[model samples]
Target chain A: MRSVSQKATPDASRRSETARRAILTAALDLVGRVGYAKLTIEGIATAAGVGKQTIYRWWPSKGSILFDAFLSLTTDQQDGALPDTGDLAADLKLVLRATVDELQDPGFDLPMRALHTEIVHDPVLAADYATRLDEPMRELKRDRLRAAQRAGQMSEDVDLDVAVDLLFGPILNRWVQRTGPLTHEYVDLVVDTALRGLKP
Target chain B: MRSVSQKATPDASRRSETARRAILTAALDLVGRVGYAKLTIEGIATAAGVGKQTIYRWWPSKGSILFDAFLSLTTDQQDGALPDTGDLAADLKLVLRATVDELQDPGFDLPMRALHTEIVHDPVLAADYATRLDEPMRELKRDRLRAAQRAGQMSEDVDLDVAVDLLFGPILNRWVQRTGPLTHEYVDLVVDTALRGLKP
Candidate 1:
């Protein structure tokens, strides 16, 4: 929430950072407890112990607040890169299994599902999600695939976009639809099966 | 509304059939117009010109009503079987392309998104969806894959459930997350890539 002004001293910036973290943390906690449909700015403000004006100054809506909260959580785990151990299958399996673990964690599950519920019906939020979360995460995955291509592990003509989907889609769809169990073995199979078609 | 008793007669069955159709049709229309969140039994009753008791008697809740309405729509199109033309690629492409068309259709899109939105947050509704809709659809798709396996078009070691997810998951994920455009070309690539890994 720090602005580009000379008046933003180190003390002020630290205060701003503390408040920002509080607000985002509160947003996630409140959403998890009350659910997204019932989440409100007033509730978030009350939970965060901050004025509604502070939240308003930063995020325009509850969706945006939740988005930032989820994004912050992801950023903490990933460094915006998939592992490239020169073994595509092993690397992908490692990353996806971590994802499986995170999804299964109760703390992460509620807020994440809440964000998805908001994103599904709201186009503006969905677009924001794509630009901010989905695309960047996809790009990191694509970077790994591109490395595979360069290593001659994958074909030149393969569409990385489609490949990313084939690799990640099943896990995602299963999680969202509750169509199957999310387990390390499932992701391992996904990686192995998808790699066959992706490889040169 | 017909009970299995001596009082149940041909005239009563005919009237029940007409009312059932009206209720299902009205549920879809009202959800499309006002969305699932704002939709109510009272509104559906008013729209269908039936008593609220009639809808309550037939379906336990709004979610159940929507489920039946959607099932009715899908039943009108697919006969619980994916076309088995022996050419696995051709058969899947044909079915997936029709799905692409349906998802793009506004009438189908709205109610479908609504059902998904409801399913994400509500475990009870999600369970009903999996039992009543998702499982039946997946079974039909699996049957086609099984046929491919028997014909030696796909490997015997291939897990049909994983294969089904690989083929359909990408498109479903893209649609649900709004991560990418749904197109014949996209599904074609998905089928091709997934088939490479699947084929013996």
Candidate 2:
């Protein structure tokens, strides 16, 4: 709790904000270590060096804590925001390149993969995973594809939804299956090759 | 072990075949009930009415036993066949549709999902899973894509490797991520859209 006297000073509020960040970081580190099934409020509090009551006061569940912790780490505050450089191909390439880097990180991949495994059987987790992660993932691609279309780089009838799904579907699939080397070259090739129809 | 005399007889071999099927079926059922981590050779032997030594003699590891059991269930024992309809689209569609059916089945999905999750972190398991499963998978897609190219359905300069990857990447992505509803309609859309370039 912020001291009433400290709250009166802007500097103490900033210090409190730093404490909140440390707590979130600690929660994320703990989730990465123990995984979803074992992640508990007390464990998070201990990791965060905050009271269990503090976490409960802010969030309802362990899943929420981990999800929010992860969300903050990505630094992507808005789901719909993608770069609008007016060059659609370059923009898509830029976003995908960032995704490639994000996916390659152990911090993001390990916990996300753990979360994904549970989501397979748990509908509540599945719905949240879809809404919070999967759909936003789709929207990321959809926005890029829409941008491409608006720039006249992609066909008008390409069906932005389907286009996004198809484009992302393969990339997502490759990542999930670990089927191939997911490098910048691979993403660029898939994007380019898909643009040029298979039939000449 | 087969006796020298019984080994010479077709009927005795038939009986051995029957027991092997029984063991494999039991293995599948048991693995479904208790996950791979909990599954045991003794349990498989008991369920199949075979001696523990019989399973041990036949399979060196539980992973091998479960692997064989799963392979038996998913495979139809076709004679090294890749679909060869003269029409490339039809041929590829037929193959993909069959895969869609296989992937959609709970019998296949459960154990496959379980094994898939396990292999994500274990490099040895990942290699084993890839060799045992992905080789045939790669072969099936490669053959189909090549057939299309040879038939002039695909671009002449189309990179066979990339095309093959594209054909199944989206489906595999959906399957692993549980991101989207994978259906024949979706498959058709993927195949069609992928075949025709996205450009206007």
Candidate 3:
């Protein structure tokens, strides 16, 4: 049986975790509805049923709140990292398929588009997003490509940075521009074409 | 020697043309400075030294005004189209290099980014820009790719739509994300990689 102190501590931690999630959810919902320009920490606090100080303690600004909310929502996928089955094509195809699913979700799409627009116009937000969101994903891709090179599966001469761009650019472009359906077949083709170009 | 009627007609036309250019320049300038959300048609007219009626007569809304302004600034490149030297690699490289130059220009980049942010937020603006700006460019790329396929330089199995995305996506990604310097060598690599993957 757990001691009273131990049970009490975990109960408090769980309650805090729940409050944090509610705050993040409220932030995403408000941003999607009212946009990032109009979103406020007070509004998010009210929506989350938390004291404004609770949010202020965790995040610096409304942008940081939204960024954290976004990061939390995507934490599972990012934490999973890209699969390394020793087959570059299959691994990339799996990751891209998952990405397409994420991008297609209305929950993720609207708030993300709002954040993306803000990032484009605000230099500070752009740098913050790049450091927190983009850099991790990029590093994961580079690591996979480097592993592929070491295994003699991909050309050592390949520029991994450019290779990363070539592999992911089409999907990002389509998502941003709303050019077409981001279907599974499309990612398969993208992976196939890119891998063909990147092979040793 | 010009006839009297021809001389007067061209003089008036030139005057009208000058006014049009001034309006566009003013629109771009204001959007760059104040952003699309804060910008108004009245502000543009005042900056251009024209009446608000003149701007309203030409463009239906502030977004339309900025869109027209952006189109006017890019008209030269659109008119020139992609070079059809019957060499796919060289032609794409030339066009992308020109694109890099245009994107790098502060005159083009700031206002374009402003308009782009607006488009991402507004669905109607997205559709409007797609029809006016994106489709024409896509059609041009498709035509070039088709010609390449006919010339046996590309695989007939290539999906033209996907091919267009793959070819232009990296450049667009770099431009939108400000991820890295879009240089001549970068475009060369993009063209080479895409073409290698695309060949029969």
Instruction: Quote the TM-score that chain A achieves in each candidate.
Output: 0.91, 0.83, 0.91
Q: Which ten residues in a row have the lowest lDDT in candidate 2 chain B?
A: B73-82
lDDT of 1 at B86: 88
The model with the greater lDDT, 2 or 3, is 3
Q: On residues B1-200, what C-alpha lDDT tens digit does candidate 1 reach at each position?
A: 54656477877899999999999999998897787889999999999999999998988888889889989999889877889978999999998989989988988888888778877777777788889899989998988999888999999988788999999999888988898889999989999999999988
Q: Model 1 chain A — which ten-residue stretch has the worst lDDT?
A: A1-10
Give one digit per residue, the lDDT tens place, for model 2 in B40-154.
8889899999999877867898788777876776566434556787766666687778778888887777767667666655557767776777767677667766666777777
Task: Compare candidates 1 and 3 on TM-score and give the better one.
Answer: 1
RMSD of each: 3.7, 3.4, 3.2
- TM-score winner, 2 or 3: 3
| Cα-based lDDT at residue B156, candidate 3 | 95
> Which pairs of residues collide in model 3?
none
TM-score, A chain, model 3: 0.91
Worst 10 residues of 3 chain A by lDDT: A73-82
Per-prediction interface RMSD in Å: 0.8, 2.6, 1.3
TM-score of each: 0.91, 0.88, 0.90
DockQ of 3: 0.62
